[model samples]
Target chain A: MTVELASIEGQRPDGQEREQDLSKSPLSIRGLTVTYGEKPAVFSVDMTVQPGQMTAIIGPNGAGKSTMLKAALGIVPPVSGRVQVFGRPLEEQRARIAYVPQRASVDWDFPTRVIDVVLMGLYRELGLLSRIRGEHKARAQECLERVGMADFAERQIGQLSGGQQQRVFLARALAQGADLYLLDEPFAGVDAATEKAIISVLKSLRAAGKTVVVVHHDLATVAEYFDNVFLINTRRVAEGPVAEAFTEATLQAAYGGRLATTQVSQLAHKA
Target chain B: MSGEEFVPLSLTPLLIGVFAAVACALPGNFLLLRRQALIGDAISHVVLPGIVVAFLISGAISAGPMMLGAAGAAVVAVVLIEAIRRLGRIEPGAAMGVVFTTMFAGGVLLLEQTDTSTVHLDVEHALYGNLESLIWLDAIGWSSLLDAEALSNLPVELPRMALTLVGVCLFIAVFWRALKISTFDEGFARTMGIRTNALGLGLVITAAVAAVAAFDAVGSIIVIAMFICPPAAARMMTNRLEAQIGWSVGFAVIAAVVGYVLAGYGPLWLGQQDAVSAAGMIATISGLILALAAVFGPCRSRAGAPAGV
Candidate 1:
């Protein structure tokens, strides 16, 4: 039913590459609807992220923010949607993208070194028997140092602080050498220093013309951290520049009664 | 234990026990980390029907056909467990319990109905293997280890288990990074374009191969024990995966040797008339090792109240 409307921006091109220019938006989704059993998670959600922009996907908890991102990435099955990256299907541009998942999604007790976690970013080039060569280690080390975690290379991953763990994940994404980065709650449950370090790394990525999209929670940090905001609550609400789309009306619409009036107003005024 | 006396009777079973334990323990490390340790128990339990069906089909107790049967059974059990879990909407542990137990029961009943007057295929043999009987009658002494003819007469289970261990080791070595990543964080592995589902299936299948091979040699008792106890105990010892695997292999070898010697001679030392089952003792020893590690291993606790918290 929404296919006709989604056709306005063009259908998600089949797996084949389109002749469109490479300057197309880094990510674009049309008519995306996802459901788990009978309950809909995201419905008819359409979002587009322009190149070189820092965008935040914000919604109240359980508003399908993560699901929408996952569906767009083909991590989760979407009922009806087309997702494209750089004017081509996502699979085609995988080498140019890096994804930093949430900190809590993995078992922290896994027996691995901090450096090895960062080296996974270079997995694209690894072969069955290919050893982790000197160059790969150097790159991983550089990424770690970039995140200010240079001294904890040999430590067990389980022994690290949550903020340190999050830095390791970012370091991994940095090691990917990706043109586009997608992060899920990179700032959640981290110390202030960790938050500042992550934001700066992302800002550097933005300055280098790499598109970055984050699934964010803190409304207060929205205007400071991201250049654009995509507010979604089960469906697309408002999206655009932080100063324009992030208003009291949009915050109310996205948060609904779940957020107190004062909190929304405070966030809107803060933005 | 003199070499002349030990060469023919105890050598083959001891070597087979060690090989089987190490083979299962290698893959067991990843399974333990993945929290799929029960898959080993599941695979070991389900091996009974596989072996029984193979014996019935071939009308013999040969290794090849019995192995094939066991492999087929393991696959069936995995698929059925998955199906029940999905269709019935039950938890995975419950689904595994249901499928493995039902298949194991069916196997026990099948063993009862079959005619076994001439062969050694019985419920007791399947449950607790005849390890003492797998002797090297042709081995005259330690020199027999160097003799080609004597070597040829060695128990087939030895070579088979050695090959299985190598295969498991190779699989782990080749896919070590992927396994570690997928086991720790499946979503991130998938996002990195690794086929997590296929890799997971590959891992389960590898575990099944180890379980089936070890089950054939030493029975399901040791299979279940080796698949969990050694790796779990090793987990308490080290926080490094490389070190953990090293510790697991060491523990497995120790359990096999110590358990076999005790089973063979502990009875005489205690003034008993008969020897105990080497399989039972080996399992018990591994369990004891796990208990000890749980109490005193350096990394026994969960990494200092989890700094991440």
Candidate 2:
């Protein structure tokens, strides 16, 4: 089903005001090449994520969208590239960047509670071995409430549904108090209601002037959900405003022959 | 033995067992949580070669030389495991199996060359241990603790195990937050400047030390059992890290006390005169406790706990 594009800044009407500011973009990757053993996952990809916007990195399966994000977060060491957050190297600007790995990356059955996971966001703020005072607990509860998980704070993480798990992760990112959030496949396996909630949260994040870069797969809602779209296969194909840059031609280039069938089905359904 | 004579003998072994149990189980929780429980088993096996080699070089069976050798062997064992994991491209479990078995075999071969006829250095002592033999007989009564001569006769194992447990408690206390965060999520902890690699390496080293410290009193089997079982059982009881650790230590101490008494009296209960090996009994009790927890503990349904979150 088509999603509502009314709230999304699909094309910047005040284009002059949104001029490319390399120093101000929340995230910028230059010549980022990530290799897995002998094979390259992402090759010399260069992209910038503007602040105060929701950017979607979209492509087919095995398109290195997650790899690019992992490289930028330093989870996977880039073979050759530099990642900058707010015009500084990732290491220098680490405090301002928050990353949410794939929901499947962590063990859901780990012996930990919902509050413990959220409190991890405050590890840097609390420092080592210091007691988590009431103020810190209050902040974590506030973040959990933002994602509608305040009621489930005491539940074991494994008890949560996939959508609830996604919300918990989003709450954790909110607790991080970072200027930029990088989410990898957050919408995967989530219910429609969770998707709406997540989008609303993303909209709020943008409203608060925080940047969010999400690795998304559903091409139908890319324009509707995000202000900017970055299209890639192994290499970056195109990137900019969704209306201008996310064309059928670019989708075909990113997905090869797979896009043509999907386009035809959409056209058939529309007719 | 009369009840009067049983007092001092039981107290010393009981204390030693408690110390060993507490020491091993403290770090055991972290090891189990980190999905490196086998490393405790590996370190225990690998330290045998170190202790044997140190005996050959120092030509003495003193604690200092033995500790040095055990520490050296434990470090080398970890390095070899990592080397095999990275260079040999082997999975961690297989690599641990390869290094520990080989090093332990080498230790056995070396032990054959050295004279192990002495009670303290006997090969049997390495496996079964001699908790019953650790009696402070000279300390005739509680007042003997005030007598320097009587106190001097106390088994070194008692003090050594006690000190190790104290040290482990302090280490876990001081680094609680770092350990919890790093164990929960290493990559994110790294991004938060946790020095995750150093914290992880430090944890492995601490486990090695605990295994080595408990090695002489409880033997490797008991050390391995204490390392895995109490923590595994405790994990089945609670989801909070602090509570899990507390439960693990509590379970460990309980197992130690009950196991020591059972080792001494279980045969009597069976209408036999001979007591069982205290180390074997301790390990067996730990297994029983684990089974009980798995069946009836609050979090038993989530027992698998899934390695590497």
Deviating ranges (above 4 Å) for candidate 2: A1-23, A261-271, B1-7, B74-92, B146-149, B303-309
Q: Which pairs of residues clash in candidate 1, taking residues 3 or more apart in a chain or in different chains?
A: none
- Candidate 1 lDDT tens digits, A1-271: 2333444567553333232333578899999999998999999999989888899999999889999988887778889999988766888777778989999988888888899999888888784568889999999999999999999999988888899999999999999998789999999999999999999999999999899999999998998888999999999999999988999999999988888899888888878
Between which residue pairs do clashes occur in model 2? none
TM-score of 1: 0.92
Model 2 is docked with a DockQ of 0.34
Supply DockQ values for each candidate.
Answer: 0.53, 0.34
Identify the CAPRI category of the predicted complex in candidate 2: acceptable
The Cα RMSD of model 2 versus the native structure comes to 6.7
Model 1, residue B271: displacement in angstroms?
2.7
Best by DockQ: 1
TM-score of chain A of 1: 0.91
Chain A fold similarity by TM-score, each prediction: 0.91, 0.88
The residue-by-residue lDDT of candidate 1 on B1-309, one tens digit each, is 688879999999999999999999998998999888988888877878888889888998777887799888877987998999999999988998898899999998998998865676787777667788889999888999999999999988889888988999899998988887788778777777778889989998888888877777788889899999999999999998889999999999999999999998999999999999999999999999999999999998776355465
Backbone clash numbers for all candidates listed:
0, 0
